[model samples]
Target: MSDLILHHYPMSPFAEKIRAVLGYKQLAYQSVLMPRVMPKPELQALTGGYRRAPVLQIGADVYCDTALICDVLEHRASTPTLYPPAVKGATRIIAQWADTSLFWAAMAYNLSPKGAAALFAGTPEAVAKAFVQDRAAMAVGMTRLRPGDATAAYRSYLRRLANMLSDQPYLLGDAPSLADFSAYHPLWFSRVINPVMADILDATPGLLPWMDSIAAFGHGRPAELSPLDAIAVAAANTPAPLADEPFVDEHGIPLGSRVTVTPEIFGHEATEGELLAATRMHYTLRRQDERAGTLHVHFPRIGYVLRKAEG
Candidate 1:
């Protein structure tokens, strides 16, 4: 296995979730601090076009979407399992809900005028504007919650999470699982990135202690690697062999067919390549770029759409 390389920025909430997981697993990884906004050319070279933050690059395989990335990490470090068998189904279901619904609500509330001001406090006006524009582009096709409505929903969700912790230390149980990490990142943004808006958390007093406990994990050992260097790392290696699972095609697409895999919602950029594998859970594509050489980009089947590339 090539060195684990994470392409992320400092304030990305999803990236923070992955960082916490890495800490819990005590995994050492090299960090590539990617651009927080657009023109992530170096990172895109490996991912084809999937430009989500915190992409996990192992050898020449690029894992997009935190949902799939979490699964990959779980496979790599199975000792402290993210999916406990006792509540495995419940853990995944709640995690999906938290990652999408809870996350969007918290972000809408956190990026309100006041929260945005505080988050970009002291930053150059043009830089802040660029950041706002970039996110707006990503949200174009999605229905965003109004700030007031988002506040209500976020509060309600936080209360629900607090209720789960009535007897347990983490969301699913005494041990932290995927659900806890999914639930913590959005709240982490509110408290850490936009402290001005963190008072919303006070409404759920039980949450503070839980949040502190999760934060105690700390980001695992990370040494910085330049973006260019990270790309070179990809070019220097070949993707690991694909899993020996039977193709479980649902889209009528066969292996070796040229296809495009795109996110169903935000970050609609399509990654086009030859379909390599469509396992029960993920889709892998073989794509090549001059800078990154040949790579295998993988996406979870749940939130992405797979289509044959048009001529």
Candidate 2:
């Protein structure tokens, strides 16, 4: 097995989720720091164009999306399972809610005028404007929650989480599962990154203790790896072999077709490549770049759109 390399920035919420998972699993990995915004050429080379944060790279296999990354981690280290056999289904469903609805609401509330001002306090005006524009581009078609609406929704969600935590040490049970990690990251952003806007968390007394417990799981042992070196690692190796299962084609598209896969919501950049595997749960794209060579990029099926590439 190739060394696990995570390409991420320090402040990415999704990356934080993966970091905590790494900590819980006690796994050591290589850290490839990435820019917070666009022009991520090296990272894009590995992913084709799925420019989401916290992409897990193993040799030439690139795993996009934290959900899939968590799955991969679970496979890599199965002792402390993210999905307990007793409540696996419920844990996954709650994780989905946390990643989507709860995440948006918490972020909107955190980036409100006051929060934004605090976030960019000493930063130059141009830099702040660019950040705003970049995020706007990513969220083009999605209906974002207004600041006021987000506050209300966030408050309600926090209370619900408080209720959940009141009984158990962790969300699904005594041990922290996928639900705890998923639910913690967005709130982690609010509390850690945008502390100025984190007062909303005060209302739910039970939530803070839970947050503390989750935060205690520091990021796993990470050795810094330059982006260039990470790319070199991919270019030097071949992608891992795929399973021999029959192609599960739902789009009338056959295997080996030129296709594009993109997120249906935010960060809708398309990655075009030869369709290598279209399993029920995910899609694998085989794309080559001058610097990254032949890489197999993987994306979860739920939040992405798959279409045959136009010639």
Candidate 3:
């Protein structure tokens, strides 16, 4: 198997989710740090235009979105499974909610005036402004929860999580599942990234111990890889062959058509390519770049929009 190369930065909550999963599975991987802001030139070479943090690169195959990455990882390493059979359906649903609703509310609260100041403390004013503007551009069409509303919603969500943890060590059962990993990242950001805003967690005492247990699954051993070197690896390798599954086309677009795929909400940059595979769960695009050669970019079916490319 090729090295599980994860392109991510330290502060990405979604990246933290994948890192924790790697740790739980005891898998070793290579880490490629990516820019937190825009103009990720090397990564864009591999992904075409799907610019988001924490892309998983296995040779020439690039897996975007943590949800799809989780599935890929589960396929690679199944022991201490993320999707426990009994709660697989519920686990996936909960994970989706945590990745979207809970994530936004927590981020809104964490990036409030007080929180942002603490977050960017001692950083140059220009750098801080750039970060804010970059995020604003990504959030163009979506509505963000106001800080006050976010605080209220975050508090309520925390309490609900506490209720879920009151009985069991993990959210679904005795062993950690997708639900636990999904729910932990936002709180991980609150508690780890911006400790000043983490006072909110004090209201839900039950969550603290659960968090400690999850945190204990330290990120697995990671050797650093240069971005350019990672790109070269992709250029040298061909993407693995796609499964022989029939296309499940919800859109009028056909398998060989030129198409674009973008996240439906935040980070909506579209990636244009020839549609290669549209399985029940994901969409794959075969795109080429001078630096990265041929690559198959994969995105989860949910939370993403796929459309025919305009001439």
Q: List the residue pairs that clash in candidate 2.
A: none
lDDT head-to-head 2 vs 3, winner: 3
lDDT of model 3 at position 232: 93
Backbone clashes in model 3, listed as residue pairs: none
For model 2, how does the per-residue alpha-carbon lDDT over 1-311 read when each residue is reduced to its tens digit? 23999999999999999999999998999999998889799899898888889899999999999989999999999979999999999999999999999999999999999999999999999999999999999999899999999999999999999999889999988999999999999999999998998899888878988889988988889999999999999989999999676778899999899999999899988999999999878999999899989999999989999999997
My TM-score estimates for the predictions, one after another, are: 0.98, 0.98, 0.99
Candidate RMSDs in Å, in order, are: 1.1, 1.1, 0.9
54-162 in candidate 1: lDDT tens per residue? 8999878899989999999889989799999999999999999999999999999999988888989999999999999998888788999999999999999999999
lDDT of each: 0.92, 0.93, 0.95
Candidate with better TM-score, 1 vs 3 = 3
TM-score of 3: 0.99
Best by lDDT, which number?
Answer: 3
Q: In candidate 1, how many Å is residue 249 off?
A: 1.6
Sort all candidates by lDDT, best to worst. 3, 2, 1
